[model samples]
Target chain A: MLKKERQALIIKQINLHNKVLSSDLSLTLNVSEDTVRRDLHELAQENKIIKVHGGALSKSYNVTSQQSDTYAYEEKNIIALKTISLIKEGMTILTSGGTTMRAIARALPSNLKATFITMSPLIALELIEHPNLEVILLGGKLSNDSKISVGGEVVNRINEIKADLCILGINGLDFDGITDSDWEIVQVKKAIINASRVVIASTISEKLNSALRLKVCNLKEVDYLITELPSDSPTLLAFKEKVNHIL
Target chain B: MLKKERQALIIKQINLHNKVLSSDLSLTLNVSEDTVRRDLHELAQENKIIKVHGGALSKSYNVTSQQSDTYAYEEKNIIALKTISLIKEGMTILTSGGTTMRAIARALPSNLKATFITMSPLIALELIEHPNLEVILLGGKLSNDSKISVGGEVVNRINEIKADLCILGINGLDFDGITDSDWEIVQVKKAIINASRVVIASTISEKLNSALRLKVCNLKEVDYLITELPSDSPTLLAFKEKVNHIL
Candidate 1:
């Protein structure tokens, strides 16, 4: 089989069985253990799976398949509250689409007079109820899974706007930058980075060391990284040392 | 063959031949001339073909299988101009996804100050260049075919917002109300209607008297219906008598 096909099969196997050993993958694909480990590492970088001492595990399977509404509601709500606290009236902000961003949208004070620009349909609906806020939607090819805009057209649009702040949701983050598994999403995130003056990323602790196939930006691109955990947490500290700020 | 399928086949033949007499199609499809004329008339109602003297000719063959970006451009532009004229500085507007609405977005003046809420990625991008406008996008299931947001989540979000104006794109407009071909789209339109104080519909003359599978709202639901043709046109007169203001 082609390498792409083999890698697809490996991902499928891991998805089905919840884990896969190097030995099993090597034998199944007629490759060496070293090769299998390399494949596992690549997939790990994509944040598609977690590489353990022996094998790989699914990365927060609960949120991977369901809508953002089904994911960690409490943690997302907390992060959202914290993110919204940074906003002042009459500011322009850019945001991505996800449960986390949706939470932040819901958390916005109804009386705040900020102008919000985003690619999430859910956020647009939320902003309409807020009489004081103005909402702008970015247009592009819509992803069936994320229900957000992601494509060349969206990227082009993002280049035209300059926002005071950008609230981002990361699937994974590390010394390298915020990462996502989908290629099209990577393009969208890049656009978000270019449009915003200050970049604030919200992610959980487990995603610290993880990487994904698409790199949205490097550590320098983000001005602040927000998490539900305290600043003293080991993982949070580790991430802070690699990046600029931890909130 | 089923009636719809047979009609589709007759339409295809007419498209291929450019013009087909009733007797000609009746011979080819092995149907009576009466049935042939009926099929032609039905397709004509959909604006899929145009009946001529003693025969029928295909509507401009520009509409391909893939999505056509060319639907009602001049008319849509006029409607867009009228729609954008309704927006005052600092007003919040709700918009649905379609080529017509996208045109309205493109027509927005750079100096115009407002907040735009929509489910279309393209509209969001267009609004970005207007420094005075804010954009908000609604998140939901994305339909690849239309490149727009749809589904229950989008509907729920629309329920949460109340906007000053709602600009809608229509597949067809009959005496009963605005109509769409897709059931999910109709659902989203319903939500948009409930969330906005005033509803303005931008449709072309061809959409008059046409009915799709999904119904959006009754004629009273929309405050203004804008079309390309003159208000004195026979079709427009017929429509105005049944509906509200026709622009």
Candidate 2:
């Protein structure tokens, strides 16, 4: 593989697992240990990752304030700004957690007044910064990997609320459905979709056509799809027919 | 007042109100605005506060990661270590949010197995670092100042669960009761006290014998009082008769 392609894959691995072992990367990439070490060191020096004794940790995973160092932060921030245009005054919005959602919360206009219901504590913390916004945190057993509330309690709470909009920061978006690896989080995401009148899927362009272990919902269920790229970009052309609107 | 005394009071004021303007501090302290500005600048230089254009913010109130710059961090950490001795294996621990509780969560042993229920999203994020701990975040409307879920929903959730131990990072503890400034948070703390089998109040020595506007519970309700001071310290003598133990 090309060096750029190999480094991108390593970053993807770190983003997925929050932490990656150099030994495991060496085995998976079929590269020597020295090559893996060099890649990790280069990434660390670039402020992309925090190199540890045995491996490296994603910057966003450890520090919530260090969004500048997050993988694809610029693209995610673009998605955040685009997502803001959909929000209206006095609307009740439900949200699932991820770096994309965090960016959205940070980018919200200070004058906008809305009610936000989220399963992620980090997002809830960020949303409360807006004086005009009301933030409701869905309480339940928190998933360590996802850093959001999950389990049956969260779904039960979602069932009782009728929100005007739902924003999902999904892992994968394929022709069939929105898929994620964790079953509990997927369950919460599914409930969120059912509870809202309109559902918007916000992701980066790279997540297009990707599928994970578990399916969350079908592409038809999403009313809007927002990505970093322009609506007329060739990368999003195929998904135009799948959703009601592409932004 | 002595410069040391004035600076100490300034830190106390910052802790009470997350953000304080130099003009307000000058009026409250009966000092010139220039003196207040100089004090804020010195505190900012020591990394004790984050000075802004017209005022300053408590280090712990904004960036959760910058705990080292938190006021009396060493004292709070010492209390955290002592509080750990009270926990046993497989206990269900309920926590309130504050720098003191955050210290305790960070100090928890990795091998210890326990379940933690908390209203603060920040504490939940900190507690999840322990692999063996189960973290349940009570969902409700989040308080912007406290950064914890508050309201009827949170109190109802606390009513359902019977926690083995409740750890309260109280603002004030006096002969009358455990007190705080916010009415909504005091209600939630009162509920937590009634829902737990034993209540533990963790606070710094400075807060001892201080009383705020709202009362959470009576002194007799607390099972233990843990502070940075030794149990036999003269500062704790007044509180010795009110609680079962003081550490």
Best by TM-score: 2
Shift of residue B213 alpha carbon in model 2, Å:
1.0
Q: Which stretches of candidate 1 lie over 4 Å from their true place?
A: A1-247, B1-25, B32-67, B232-234
Off by over 4 Å in 2: A1-69, B1-69
User: Which lDDT tens digits does candidate 2 get at residues A1-247?
Assistant: 4454466678889878999999999999999989999989977766677999888998877776855437798998999999999999999999999988988999999999999999999899889988799999999998988899999989999999999999999899988989999999889999999999999999998999899999999999999999999999998898889889999
**Candidate 1 lDDT over residue span A146-190, tens digit each:** 667677767877898899999888898887778899888888888
Docking quality (DockQ) for each candidate: 0.02, 0.34
Each model's chain A TM-score = 0.70, 0.73
**Model 1, C-alpha of B246: deviation from truth (Å):** 2.6
lDDT of 1 by residue, B1-247 (tens): 6788888887778668666777777787788888888888777655567665566766643222222345456777887887777788988899988788878888888889888888765566566657676776665445534556677767887898889999998888788777776777778889999999999888777777887656788998888888877667787786666666777
Instruction: Locate the minimum summed-lDDT window of 10 residues in model 1 chain B.
Output: B60-69
- Report the interface RMSD that candidate 1 achieves against the true structure, in angstroms: 16.5
Residue by residue across B31-84, what tens digits does model 2's lDDT show?
A: 999999999977775557777778887775534333232567789889999999
